[model samples]
Target: MTSPQPTPAPGRVGSAIGWSYVVTAGRIGSSVIVTFLLAKLLGPSEFGLLAMATVFILFAQTLIQQGLVAAIVQRDKLTAEHLDAAFVVLVLAGLGVGLLTAAVSPLWALINRAPDLTEVCLALSPLVLVQGLSIVPEAILRRELQFRSIAIRTLLASVLSGVVGLALALGGAGIWALVGQQLVNAVAGLVVLWLVCPWRPSRRPKLGAIRELWAFSAHAANAGLGSLISSKADILFTGIFFGPVATGIYRLAARLPDMLVDVTVRSIQQVSLSSLSRLQQDRARFAAHLVQLQHLGAVAGLPVLGVLAATARPLVEFLGPQWAGTEIPLQLLCVFGAVNVFGVLLGPALQAIGQPGKLAAILWSRGLLGVATLAAVGALITSDDPVGQATAVAVAGIAIQLTVNAASIWVTVHRVARASIGRFLAPTGPAVLAALAASLVPFATDRLGVDELGPLARLLVVGAAAGLVAAAVLWSTDRPLRQLVTPRLMRLRRTRAATGTPAGAHSVEASATRSTEK
Candidate 1:
């Protein structure tokens, strides 16, 4: 048996999370600008065509990565041969998947009854190969906790790709503009990843080095595929039943909540896999970090989602009249996003503890349930109204999320991690309560004629009010959170003060005072 892995230092973990947040923040910011510009320049049918083609690309991506990233990061020992083997396997898989995607593009379009999607899929096929080349290198970076480099790659790619997409949109390239964005993003990321990741594949790479990794990666891949299918099932069903226009609208609505999760929950989840994997042998430390990360994720993520749900109408309105059908779905999805934040750590934590099979089983079960419920909704709802159909889909989605995700959390915390259910859930209670409290701020303000202020103004006022309310509630109820955030606040204050810049001294003092009360 191999020796236990060393636990990651707190500072290292914090830095990783910090950089990952930067990556996600930049990505979301660039994407929002690109999305807004493209929405005006293109129509629903155009976006729908791209969305239809992307489902296939996403599946191909799962096969190419095959959970090798987690396997690489979670492994107790590393070898040069392992990296070479993974790189070779993935590159070949990328080429094969790309070719296969191109070959099947026509058939996929026929199935969806959208002839335009054929060229779209063909255009995106090369992206499968381009992205595949970067997998092992990116994995290596994550394993080494080199998130700063990853952040740089992500930010640069998002901006450049967004620029390319917007330029094409402005030039009236329509759907191809969206297509170009995807291709550029993948290529840019691949180039930057190779530059930062110094390891290169050997000339005589051997598959034998991956034999051990396969045992881990196989289950990780299954878990990943299942999770992907579960998340994408609604869109797939929407595309199949409602066609491209509805699919485009639904996709855009779903993207908002998904982006919100990416901002904090998903970033923390990515860092948790690497950090938790390092602490696997230290059960006490592993448990501590696991719970702390979960608590922090909920504290930071759920409230934002809650505010989004409460203020979704104004948020969606900002996208213009073409996006009229988005508000209801966006609100429902925000709830799903909030619940999803709680479960984000489950897969990474399980994989880190060498229980990827458990994660796979849970995810697959959830996927099947999600698919079945969505199919039922599709069959029962005879409404030709794409917006109504999409709304029903969103409702079913959140219901599935609430049931499966809650149970999965209980299983991960109480059964696998050996913590009490209450201990696992206690941190989230304050967050949930705070979210409800924050949401009420919007409800009350809206009742008091906040709608008269216009969408943008209402959004700003509601967002600010909800955020402040959530922060106050969380600060009052959660002692550990105050302890966790106070030092960071103080450090920020000291930096700004020393630099002769303005800072929120009162907020820092309040947090500091609350932390001491613990």
Candidate 2:
């Protein structure tokens, strides 16, 4: 048997992270625009209906993707036969999920006590199919580290989706406007992926060739179930106990933190999975990379989560008066956000080290804890007060989830990555302390006199002040962050000198690295 040759360690991690930031910024900007317009056009009830529809669509989409894309990305070798079989399986699964969603829409509406939810779910069913088709092509781009292309495609889709949704809502389409927006985004994304990705299905499927792939994907499916539960448990609980209006508030409140976490941590995971997969056989190199990633997670995540936690009230109030109830839930969720960043990074590390089952184990434990916490909280809160119930449930679940996720990542880092406890805790502990100190600026300001400021002005002041303080603190105390951010800045200077396009330098470097490796 021939040993797997070591894959090249492309210098694209930084570039990938940059592209992710740019893409995330564009999406966030577009989201803010769409959200403001939607809130003006639609009332809380309509927004709630749209939020509920999205939860169902997201749940189905998660199941259909099932981490198979990551599995494919981590593989040492890729072939046309493998991509074909994966696509075939995904399409079949998408069809099944779509059918199941349609079949169960009425049941869901009945259970949730929302008669209109059935129509909303039925309207959103095609999204599952669209997402399933898009997954493989997007995975192919990610596997090849074509983040620039991915970023461009995502920006276009976000723009189109937002524009269409806003137009429809202004034209009095109500919740259907939201549904149409999602379908448009999905279809547009699939079209872009098909156009940008060069891969095409072969003439025939090779079932035997994909069996090992399925073995990997089966474990991924287990992990993905846990991931889905972790991601959606709060929304599900809110919808069940607090109703659609409360869910809408929770959804919007959680949006900023979720976007930041996903953009920062998941972007790293994308590059890490491909990069670390290349270093799988070198235990020393793999361990070193894991350490660097742990620090990276803390340096990037802690301050962001802290700032959000500190300024959540102002942020929520500024968004709208209806959003004020979201403050506590958003703050409590920041702890989970910080812990989840580490857990997410570790899962990719396990997969890169050829331990997909370990990732599955960790996620399963997390999901179980999350569900139990939610159930217990629900049992305790029988009140008709939606915001109160939602707050209690969110606080309890996030606390349990933070504990469970932290323990899981620690174990994975120690057992799978073979790192010591001290090493594991060192970077994160200090970063958290530094973040807390930096976060106090906003908290103290809110306590002192800033409370009198109007919500909009207060939110802007707190957000800007918190950002500047956090950056200064991070640059002063966090050497790793300085190192990481500094090199990229220098590279921009060099690229500007050479090509006179500082903006395009990172993407150019990324493309060059991928080409050299190929």
Candidate 3:
């Protein structure tokens, strides 16, 4: 048995955040390249097939990877037995999930009336096992605050997998390019994780260890399952009703917002969960820290999503004419993404405070609401036009989701944590104002005849205008952010002067490697 480590120091926490952003940036860049290339090469039908198979992969991976790995991170104390037991459980779960997916692939395809998807699903089944193998190790790295290693693994895997996918696409491999990309990413990431992480699981599974972890992990898994259902419901409905082409269009529309959330919101959530969990026992610190993170999320995440929504038309047009129908849905989804920026923290905050059951309840409620609303929208919005149907459904779905997320945030911040609602929401005013002010830039550009420019040129000009406006507004109004940034800049300058050496990626990676080795 080992005693729990203390909370991470500010410097370590800062490094964790930096590396997390590095990983996020790398993934976003690679994803943008690979995704557009494949979309252009294979067209809508192929992507729709990939999306269908991915739905199953996402669900199954959540089952195997979410619960126990989260338990390991949230637990106050951990031992070799716990790690070993979690690893064994994940491995077994992965094997079972992969086999089940393979067996059910045909049935799923049959249900969807897409015979081609059967093979696609089968091809992607092994991802469950490959991805599962890395979960515990990845969790261990997170728990240890070894984000630099994780960053490296992530960047490397993304780049390599993007190359593979691109090469296959260029070779006219169709949807298999997408399929191969996922598998290679999972496998490459797993290999890098094993290489970087020092912990090796022994072949021992203890019932006691599993039970101790299950106390938290069960709820964590349930909450994750619910969240997944909520997130994936729109895709499910679109695919089933509108077929692959419509599904593909809707999927692309959702993709940018989803990627923005992943890059901004989820990355922050990952770092925050670890930090918040460490501060759980200190009430004042915990509450203050939570609110500050909310402020950060609003200031940082909201503006980016707003800009994306504002520039959605030009951005989607740049993708190709095949994506002509994506603009409205993308804009709607960006609004959902904005709501997520504010509400996403509620889950992690609850989880950190040892209220997994509460989080689970909130998420399940959201999931139910999401499903019901999406179903109603799907049924009510009868149209021969797929794009129109998708837009209608998106409007309805995003509206309901916004309400649910707002309520969830209220429960977590106002009711459970007993934080001041005004204080929790203080930053949002400036954030929304800034986001709105920034959004006007793209509209102004359009008014100035920027629409006559090429899609890429319009995107660049509009994106730049929005970004500059957002930055200026935030810099002017977000005092807390300014306060946070000034000190960091000062510290960096002082450190640079003291060392007379640049502190860059190589240095961060090297230091992290040394720390890992030691």
Candidate 4:
């Protein structure tokens, strides 16, 4: 991957972020709708079986597209030859994974002792090939920073696929409903991506371009493996020992907090890596970007996760009373997800700066530690207590995630940016206090004999108070929070003067200049 010669313009950066939020918002809205419907329609056992099948599919997905997609996004120059080569790689990998998935489904089913997994895996095999066909087109758009088209396509696919999934579940298709959703999402997403970014490849595969991508791909392959472990190893462990019911409950436990953190982090991530790659040669600009992203992301992220953790009871119940069994696990996952989000940008930052090997190491360390901890904890759970096992996993997960993320952030900030960890995490201090302050509302409200209040009411009280406390703390403690809108306002003034042409549309450069001048 070559370096982006020029830093992305501020207008472009702002536009990218704005469109990314839309993409997230659209997907989230549809996902919430789909999840709620699925939770209501499917029982725990059925969902658990589906979850187990998904681990295999996701593993296949990681191999088929993730490494190549990341390489494409990071590559500074894109040739038809390069894209053609990527498409060829994806096709071969997808075909191999699909056949391998079909071959191993029965063995996985035997291990999990879920006969349904064998069939579900077979049904999902075609998706591997279908999605492989989609990656290059999607990467082409992403590398060009064409997020609006991506957002519209995603939103449309999500809504359409969600409708199909909901209908299937309601019609008593059970586990197949979830399977149907995956299939629909893939087909719909691919179609829309192709429609919007319709550039057909004319060149045959170029070995030279493929070799260049391998420069990024080799380390990226490790990072992808680590990601697979970090994301799915728990589900794998749960399915192996506890059965579909437990795995389903674990899925429910993890769903919301993961959604919240993922949505919040992705809003920045869609632009951060690609945009930041260009400015890496300018250390001052790069450091300033890292500082602002970490601080702002924490200020927003901490309170959301904190509130969710503290109020997991109502949130779990909000899904349905049948899901009450997952309350504690949900709480644990909320906290775990909250702590882990701090390091989300670190791996991306390293990869963007041409240190994919370093990122692979960090991700591998975390993934391995997580898997080991899950195994050790699994060995200790001899009782038939699924919730208890989940609780143990959650606790270990939080501790491990926090430790790894904190250490990784420290190393990345100090080594790469020459910035202190204190500066990196400074925003968290007040954010924590705000979260603590927010927790008090629920405590006080419960004391007021409103324990019978609906989950929504309790959530509103706690969430609103948390939002206020977070704002107050950031406003009081973080200077950047005070002028959050100043840049946009300045840009608006400049835009008016220029009659709507962008004025120095590189936000990081502008922000860095301001910091240095001060």
lDDT agreement with native, every candidate: 0.83, 0.75, 0.81, 0.77
Question: Which order, best to worst by TM-score?
Answer: 1, 3, 4, 2
How close is every model to the real structure, measured as TM-score?
0.93, 0.90, 0.93, 0.90
Distance from true location, Cα of 430 in model 2, Å? 4.6
Best model per lDDT: 1
What's the ranking of the predictions by lDDT, best on top? 1, 3, 4, 2
Clash pairs, candidate 1, are: none
- Candidate 4 residue 169 Cα shift, in angstroms, is 1.6
Candidate 1: worst-modelled 10 consecutive residues by lDDT:
508-517
Clashing pairs for model 2 are none
Clashing pairs in 4: 9-505, 9-506, 10-505, 10-506, 10-507, 11-505
Residues 345-373, candidate 2: write the lDDT tens digits: 77778888888887777777777787888
Candidate 1 residues lying further than 4 Å off, grouped into runs, are 1-5, 487-518
lDDT of 1 by residue, 1-518 (tens): 14445666666677777777778888998898788778878877788888888998898889888999889889988888888899899989999988998998899899888998899999899988886798888988898888889988999999999999999988988888999999899889888888988888899988898897899999999999998898888878888778887888888878878888898788788788888887677777677778778777888788888787777888777777887868887877787788888888888989988899999999899899988998898789898887788788889988998988778877787777877767777878888888888777866896889988988898889999888898899899988786667787787778897886666543323432232223
The better-scoring model by TM-score among 1 and 2 is 1
| Model 3 TM-score on a 0 to 1 scale | 0.93
* Clash pairs for candidate 3: none
Q: Which digits, one per residue and each the tens of the lDDT, describe model 4 over residues 1-518? A: 23344667766766776677678878987897689779977777877888899888888887877577778888777677888888888888889888998999899899988887899999988888887898888877877778889998999989999999999988989888898998898889888888999678765567567887787887888788887787677888888877887788888788777777666776677777877787777877787787777665676667777777667767667777667668788877877776766877887788777777887888788788888888887787887876776676678788888878877887688887777778777756766666556555667667776568787787666566656765676567666655764775677687868786565454433443333223
Q: Judge candidate 3 at residue 188 and give its lDDT.
A: 91
Off by over 4 Å in 2: 1-6, 40-44, 446-448, 483-518
In candidate 2 the C-alpha lDDT for residue 122 amounts to 95
